[model samples]
Each structure stands twice: as structure tokens, then as C-alpha cells.
Target: MPDAPLTDLQMKQAAERFGTPLYAYSAAELDAALSRVQAAFGDARIWYAMKANPNLTLLRRMQSAGVGFECVSLGELARAVKVEADGDHLLVNGPAKSDEEYRLGGDLGATFIVDRLGEVALLPPASRVLVRVNPGLSVSTHDHLATGAAHSKFGVRPDQLPDVLAALRSGGHTLRGLHLHVGSAIRDAGDFAAAFARVAELHTLTGPLEVLDVGGGWGLGADLHGIAARAKEAAASFGAVLWVEPGRYLVAQAGVLLTRVMGHKQTGRDFTLLDAGMTELLRPMLYGAAHPVQALWEGEATTSDLAGPACESGDLLGHDVTLPAGAVRGDLLALLEAGAYGAAMSSTYLTRPRPAEVLWDGTQWVTMRRRETAEDIWAAEV
Candidate 1:
């Protein structure tokens, strides 16, 4: 069964044990999500984009499930390596590639996703690589999140493919695959079909492609079956392996942000103030993303605005959300579907300490990451 929000008892226990404004993940949820994806995209390689949630325990769970690591930075690679992730299953991908990153990827025997000529130059001679192609196809997602548009800075432009491929050969890097990432939060199957159709045509650029990296932008309501079929059909046409890097789909619903209602007020509008804000979960402020929120107590339903302790007005967590009527101070509330980009995109804005992260393994909860401290935040400056 798909994972559901934590029970009121579990939420209360976690807050009492770890403190409020905490990130609580479910190991059972992770396992169930992995199984769903594995069953959905049978025979296709699934690489977990650790940028979503790189908690050590999450990484270990993914690794144990035979999921590969899709890393974009040296730090993520280091974490994967620490967990003894299989080197061959790893893929190094990012828009910018530093010399050190290239060297580290090569040393780890991971395939590089070459996005530009400079990245191609950085690869060792005859290294296996996939060139990220920007086919200028726009999906229904946000403009900033859409990467396949002509003006996007993410992938190699289609016009530059010839020169890029030539440069790749000149630099001694063998192009074994093609890649495209249209955007995130995509749910339309037609969008993926459009991208996959473009990928099929790009396969002509390389002789006998080994992998077709269709890219990942799947969200909660995405058409998984339709997308999987499109990819399978394309891979069958080229007889190449299909690879998908899912960052949010497999893990977003596996966690929640538990925050307490510090107090309530009526300022022309009902307000529930929370101790957490964009400082702890930035998706609402960053992308206007909405997550389901509920209260622990039972009361008349009331429409209330949820705001954080941050000074910015945009620190609003939710607008006109329904909470238990008369919910007051110390009421526990949960932000659902927060596992993906929640804590991963947090900041130390206002110098607010980040929340602790805990994992529930069906029977008990374990600390995955300790709460940040004031000294830890200022350590870099000192």
C-alpha cells in the first residue's frame, strides 16, 4: 500500500523525542516506493537523484535496493562512495563540471553526462558518456524547471550537437548514450512522449547507442505507465538500455515535516504561526509548491493561513488551509509530501537552526541527521 501520513501518536512521540519542526521519514514508505517504481519500469535502470534527499539512511536504503546513484556534485559522490555504492551503477551529471569533479567521476568509474563541450574536454580519453541534449521541447511544468527549452542553460543545444559530438570524439570521449531532462513536476504522458520522440531521433547521432537517458521529472500525479511505455518503445527501437533518474517520484511522499502551531492570531485573517519556515522547507517559497497539511486534534474545520517564523511575508507555508477549528498553541501539524525538495533546499536564513531528521522503520524511529547547531552554522566563517 502507498504510505500515508504518520499517526497522531507517532507524530507526538517524534516531537517529544526529537523536538518540533522535524523531518520524519518512513523506511517502509521508501521500500514501498522503490518496489512500485521497480515494478512500474521493469528492466529499466533507475538511478536515485540524491539531490532530493541525501540522508545517509536513505542512501543506504536505496543502495540496498540495487538503485544506482545519480550525483551532480563531488560531495554527493563522496556520500555514495561512503555507503559503498556500486561504482559502475553511478552516473555523474550536472550543468557545470569542474576539473576535480571530472577527475573524481573518472576515478570512481562512473559515467559522465556531458552537457557542454567543456564538460566533454574534461573527461578522460575514451570515457563512456551521455550528452544531455536540449531539444527545445517545453513541457507543462514551470519555465525555470523546464530544461529542454531553447533558452535553457541546462543541456547542449540541438544546433550544437554536431560540434559537440565532434569535440567529444576529438577529446577522446566516446558517446555511448543520449540524455534529456525537460523539467520537474511533470504529469502529462504526452510531454514525456514528446521528449522520448526527440530522443529516438537523436539516437541517429550515435552508432548503436548503449543507453537512452530519458531523464526524470516525474511527480506525484505523473502518468507513470504512459511514460514507461514511451521509453520502452523507444529503447526497443534502438535496442539500447533505458535509464531513468527519478529524484522526487520515489521519495517525495516518503517523508513529512512536523511542525507545531506556536500560536494563533486573527489579523483580518486567521493565522497559525509555525516555528518552521522556508528556512526549514523552501519549496513553498521557491516554487510556490503546495503540500497537504493537517492538524492533530479534532475540531470544527476552519480556513486558516499558515505562516512561518521567518521575517519575510513570503514565508507563508500555506494559504487558506483548513485546520481543526479553535486549534491553538502547541497543536502539532504535518506538511505532507515533503520528502523530495523540502529539507534538501533549506537554508540558514535568519540563522535559524535546521531541524533534526528521523526515520521510522515501521516499529521505531531512528535519527538520520542531528539538528543543526548555532556553532555549526557559524563554523565556516570562524
Candidate 2:
């Protein structure tokens, strides 16, 4: 992953000024990342997977850049609408379709990546839709992140493609395209090549296609150059426009999670306790993901376990984390590659209020989301 864009001093300043367990992103970094992908893909249409980060400030920035959004739920579409991203520029995608979601999908005229045959009926007649085909292939990634496997609950099985196509045609829905999203955080180019190749083969069975949404999950360390080439090839092979929904890759390295070492302990194993926990960022506990970590002050390298204040023992963020020898109480540690799923997936589990989120616009830190108070957490509770 790229180095944390925030400087050590800047991270420390944010921690001191805003408090620990904060998420700070760089607007400049986000722009640069978007520009890089746009330049690399050249003409392939790009859409921001709003599931990664739905902060209105970031969404407005994406909208200003002329990028579309791919929403997985009604709430995500609502968030995009709040940023003035509506019409054809938005896409509604997910496995299960709710009545309200289908209603909104048609009301907004947003493209739909239909995962099931039943969804075709749920959509408004003649509404634009793309069938998400399960390629019966799996990318070499974490199981929870894989979506294109034959048994995955994400898409329509390839064997059922013809039936789905016929269903779309008979139902009067506009079959705008086909989509295949194998998995998330794919590090190997071969995986993408295989998935795209399968989609291309399936294209032969379908009628004239206008869009090919090779769904996104490109990781921070994947081969973008090769992926870009494959995207071009897929677009050419299908004689249609290509759209990509890159989520983590575009924003993961642009933000950092700042947490302070509250204390140290040596129960069973050496542990450095921090104010942050699975509630602040769940990827560690959920997916066993490891983000690069470093302390503001440098010292001799010492391996230690890093954990959060959550009651669950599985709330550990990193096992055998190496940090500065003198890293002790009150030292700020910046967890890198947290821009994507960090605050976006945070929750009020254990009634722990969510942390604050800010963006650095080069001049200074601007608060995008304030820390949640107990009332903010309980307001919706009956």
C-alpha cells in the first residue's frame, strides 16, 4: 500500500486537536487517486462504489469530477441523491431486491445490476438493467469478499443466463448489459483476466449489449496497468461501453485511522491497548485485514500485539504488530490504508459512540462528521 499520505506531525496534530480514534482523509489524495484511475482507464466509465465511503463531502467531490456512483441500497442512493447524483449516472446493485429499492431504482432511472431473475419483475417495465452473472469462478481472495463463485449468493448462475435473458426480454425490461464481479481485494491479474474472459464468453449468448460492468473490487496493491488493459479488451470484445465500480482501491490509501496507546499489558502475550476497537474499524475483526501501523515517535523495533478497548477478545486489530520500542502510553499510532471501509463500516456496538471524521484540504482539517454522543447513538432506539 502507498505510504500514509498524512505526515507524522499532521497525524499527531489531528489526534491532539480532534482526539484519538479519529479518521482523517486528504482531499488532495482522493483527487489524485481518482485522477490516476481515470487516466489509467482512459475511456472506460468509472463509478464510485458508495459502499466504501458515503460521506457527502466525498460524494460531492466525486460528482464534481464527473464520476457516477454505484449504490447497493436505498440509503446509499439517498446519500447520492443528497449530493445531486441522480439520473443515469447512478447505479443500483445488490443481491436481494426490496420493494422500495426497486421503486426507487425506477423512480430515479438508475441502472440496475439484477442478481436474480425475480428482480427483473420487481423493476419497472422497460427499466434499464444489467444481469449479474455468476461466472462459476472464484478469485483468490478472502472467502467473505468473494462474490462470483458458483455458490456465492451474489449473482445469477451462468447456466441460467439464457433463461434470465429470455425473462428480461419477455418482461420488457431493457437488457442494457451484463456484469460480473468476482470478488474484492483481488491482488492477482490472472483472476481478473479469467473473470473477464468468462464474461466475454457469456456475451456471445446475449443479444447486442451496450454496457459491460466488470464490477469492482480492485485492491490497494493490485496490478492496475494489467487490469486497465483487460478492461479495454473486454470493452472491445463485447463491442460495448465498459464501467468499473472501484471502491477500496480508490480511497483505501488516502486516509488514516489515528489511535492513541492508552496503556500496555503482558497477559499471556504483550499487548498495547488503544482507544479504538472493532466498533471504530471492523475490517480487522471481520476480515482479518491488516493495515500498516506506525507510531508518531520512532524508537527501537519491538513486536507487540495491538488491540482495541472492545470487550471481545477478537477485537484485536493486529497480531504481532511491530512498533517503536518506546511506544507507550499516550503515543499516537496511525493505521494506514483505512480511507475506504474505516469509518464507513463503523458502528455503535457496545454503545460505544462512533469517532469523529475529518478531511484535510491542505490548509487545515475540516470536520466532515462529528463524534457521536450517547444521545446520537440512542436517539433512534425505542
Candidate 3:
């Protein structure tokens, strides 16, 4: 199967049928990505981090594949519950979980990943928990994506693990294991190696544990087998089962953002504007993420920055994008590697209706979510 789900023809068809600023996914790609992870990990428990792409259809797809969920918020937990996820298949994770999150997660019997020492006292009685460990290692990704750094607010310091463990014991909560996620879109194998080594040093403190969740930050083209080997070795030190929480790695390549070339302008930089922008996909602005752009029409190639309709001057989707010079208004463009965090982070900024989402199931298209209406946007407002 192709790495991307929709073909050029299919993307045009989707744009024509559904309208621009649409999100399209491929069912086969999602399954294939999952299979790749399962093959590399070999018996490791896989938890789909729904924060990457939490569409209900995708959640159901993950559920059918026997993949559990790693949720960080109440909405994600609710999504898991909607899919009939059992307690054994749920992991509640966040740095600052709220009371309602703890209550619902506890009611579901989900394994909560405790982000700090103070959170130990807040968990439900006898809650199963994993202590998130910050390895304090610099990684080779965007600074904003680096969560395992020493100053990051994500995990407890290694020195504090003992205190966290003691608190868990005092609170009568079950300590399932340790969790370590360095960062996202990481390209270096050495980063994972170093993190695994750092976490392994804590074996003397943790003893033999139930699980060692070396959280997933595998870049799109990362070496999974190599990373899994390191993870397995780390877990072996503690005699713990390996569990992975993969969000972007499983879904990033399977989806595309279909937007139309609405108009063009030149302001120091050649700008090809689209109907979508920071509100539709924030990674470009938030983290300087670069998604490949494919133009449907043909002509002499020209380099241009892809801009969105958002009023903010920073609402650019891509920079120095190469497209056919003949590409005109109404022509479609597919932003590749957008399957993860694209739609999940979209908003109604500027009152732009959040785009519709569709899935190509090999032979036909299925509407996963309808386009939002102006009324739908204000329905919840007073």
C-alpha cells in the first residue's frame, strides 16, 4: 500500500465532493501503521494515544484492532468510554489532572500516569498508577516538543520518583510501573538509547515492576526496531512488560488536509493562500512543522509559501512549497503527513466552520464527521 491513503485523483474527488479545507484519511494506512508497530514491538502492549487523532471512527478502528487508549483529558477518556473501552484497555495520563478526570478515570479503573509527586494524594483509593519520569536529557526535536527535558512541566524529576513511590504506597495505590516520553517527532536513535539508559538506572529503586512504558516519540521515519530493542532491554532490567503509547507515529502519514488554492499574492514572499490556516492545523505555526504540499494541477514548478485565510500574519501552513505555476484558484492541494494533530487541534477561530472529515475505505468514501455549521458553532453559547 502507498504511504499516503488518498491518491491524487481521490484527493480531487474528495475536494470536489466534500469541499475544501477538508480532512481525509485512509483506513488501510491506519491498519498498516499499527501492524508495523506490533511487528516491531513483538508482544508489547500498544496504547493508541488518542490525542493524535481522536475522531470517533478512528477510535472505533483502534478498538477493533485490540489497541488500548492513552488519554490525557476528560474528553479523551469519554471518547474511550464511548467506544466501550474496558479498564484494562485504558491509561489516563496528564501533568495536571482535574478532579472530574480522576473521578471518571478511577470509576473506569484505568491506569493513571501520575505526572508529579503531589498528584499521588489526589488519585482514587487503590488506583493503579505509573510514575512519569523526566530523564532530563536534551533530545533532537523542536524545543516545544521536548517534554523529557529537565525544565519541562511534563514528568517528575528522577530524584522525586522515590517520593512519588512512597506517596503511592501511603495512598494505597498500585504502582504499575514507570513512564518515560522524551519528546515527539524525534529522529535520533541515540536519544531513545540515552533515555532508556537513564530510566534503567532507576531499576534499583523501582525493583521488578509490572510495566515500563517508554512512551512513543518515534519520528515518522524513525527506526522502530532499534528503539524497541532499547525499550525491551530497559524493561528487562525491571522484569516489566513493555508498553508503548504511540500517537503521531501511527496516524501522521495516513491522513491529509485537502485545501484549495483560493488566491495568490506577493508580499516579499510568494504566497499561495488557502481556505485553511492556523485554526485548522496549528503545528506549522506552533512548532514550525512542515507538511509536504501536493498540487493537483500541472504546470511549470514554482516555489511559494502556503498561507491560510486566518487574519494573523503567522497563519502559514508551509514555506517554500513547490507547486505547478499553472495551479489556479479552486484547484486542490493535499497537505501530507497531517493525519495526526491536524483535525484534533482544529478550532472555529474566525467563525470558519471546522472542516469535514472523510475516510477512504479502499473502494468508497465514508463520512467520519460532517462539516460544522455556523449554528453548530454557536449552539453551546448563551
TM-score of each: 0.96, 0.98, 0.98
> Which parts of model 1 have CA positions greater than 4 angstroms off?
1-3
Q: Model 1: per-residue lDDT, tens digit, 229-311?
A: 99888777677898889889888888899999888888888889998888988888777787888678789877888899988
Specify the highest-lDDT model's number. 3
Measured with C-alpha atoms, the lDDT of residue 185 in candidate 2 is: 87
Q: Can you rank all candidates by lDDT, best first?
A: 3, 2, 1
- lDDT value, residue 321 of candidate 2: 85
When summed lDDT is taken over every stretch of 10 residues in candidate 1, the lowest stretch is 1-10
* Among all candidates shown, the one with the greatest TM-score: 3
Tens-digit lDDT track for model 3 on 1-382? Answer: 1234678888888888999799999988898899999999999999999999999999999889899999999999999889899999999999889999999999999999999888888999999989999999999999999999987989988898888999999889999999999999997989999999999999999899999999998998888999999999999999999999999999999999998989999989999989889989999999999887778778887899999998899999989988889667888888899999999999998888999999999999999999999999999999
List the global CA lDDT of all models.
Answer: 0.84, 0.86, 0.92
Candidate 3 ranges beyond 4 A from true positions: 1-3
Q: List the residue pairs that clash in candidate 1.
A: 126-172
Alpha-carbon error at 244 in model 1, in Å? 0.7
For 181-266, candidate 2 gives per-residue lDDT tens digits of 89988877799998888788876788568988887888777777788889778777878888888988788888899999889989
Question: How far out, in Å, is residue 44 in model 1?
Answer: 0.7
User: Where does candidate 2 clash, by residue pair?
Assistant: none
